[model samples]
Target: MEYSMLADIDTGEQSSQFLTFIMADEEYGVEILDVQEIRGWEPCTEIPNMPQYVKGGINLRGTIVPIVDLRQKFGFNNIKYITTTVVIVVKVLVEDKSKTMGLVVDAVSDVHTIAHSDINLPPQLGLDTGPRVIRGLVSIRDKMVVLLSSSLLLDLNQFQNIEQINEHKTQQPMATND
Candidate 1:
């Protein structure tokens, strides 16, 4: 999903856990259960014909995990990477299957526990964040947090594209140890 930069930590559901992060000077949260690991930024191999927000793919041990720049995806202005830059590796579920991907963020905020009743309904906006992208809003420490609908963050097409790229990479013939 193109992140709702104004968002905060939660599952977009009642009493859910979230891993909060910062992007484009805003806060966003994803389901903690979906998070695999958090790592610092590293250059990834660029893939041709992909969206600008898709920075590229990284070889995580053996899996080719696609890295998405939340800033660009959210249409944030040009930003320079700094020590706080990080990649939040998350296990995304697409069509009953799980795929690993990385979300690049300016920095990571803290995890927050959201009670079911505390979440406020989302306001109407014509943003690119599809209807299901944002779950709700809540106040924390007198700050508003935006909860994201983890399931709807990305559509099938993006995952399909990543899969195709990975398949293409694997199809390349290997050199013999002659």
Candidate 2:
């Protein structure tokens, strides 16, 4: 879906498209505008001293794109990557500029058109003042889809030294055959 699908002419409501995916049986979406591309699971050049969630980095043409597994990042049980596993390349706002990263998800579900009004603010669990990863929630097809604020999902500072990480690389095995 394109950003051109942002407005409904008849109703005059502002809406945006979301690229939805499934993880641990739950639906999650990232704004379509942030999506750069989707790719199949492939081994990446592993970096030393990075968090478990930071899978590694891949050479996208000439750019070294860091990959992150959402399941691991969100504290879900680790599972072997299969055919359904894919990497969604997205441009996230880091600091003031945009940075490209790959998010490893279970599988892509669909492209949903949701209106701005339909999105509900995420509840505050406690008095924690930490940055929020969830942007909002929306009901689509009678199921709740967690819309993620891509910009806040990853720790911006962790990737600031990407060039250094690229300097040290080894292939990491992430996929398996069952």
Cα lDDT listed for each candidate? 0.80, 0.89
lDDT of 1 by residue, 4-96 (tens): 233344444447677888877678888788889999999999977788888889998877888888778668886888899999998877788
In the range 1-178, model 2's lDDT, one tens digit per residue, is 4343489788999998999999998999999999999999999988677798999889987678889999999899999999999999999878777888999999999999999999999997786746888989999989999999888877866677685555554445657999
Give candidate 1 misplaced runs (Cα > 4 Å): 1-14, 126-131
Provide the lDDT at 21 for model 1: 84
Model 2 TM-score, 2 decimals: 0.87
Clashes of each: 3, 0
Model 2: CA > 4 A from native: 1-5, 127-129, 165-178
lDDT of 1 at 10: 46
- Top-lDDT candidate index: 2
Best by TM-score: 2
Error of 2 at 98 (Å): 1.5
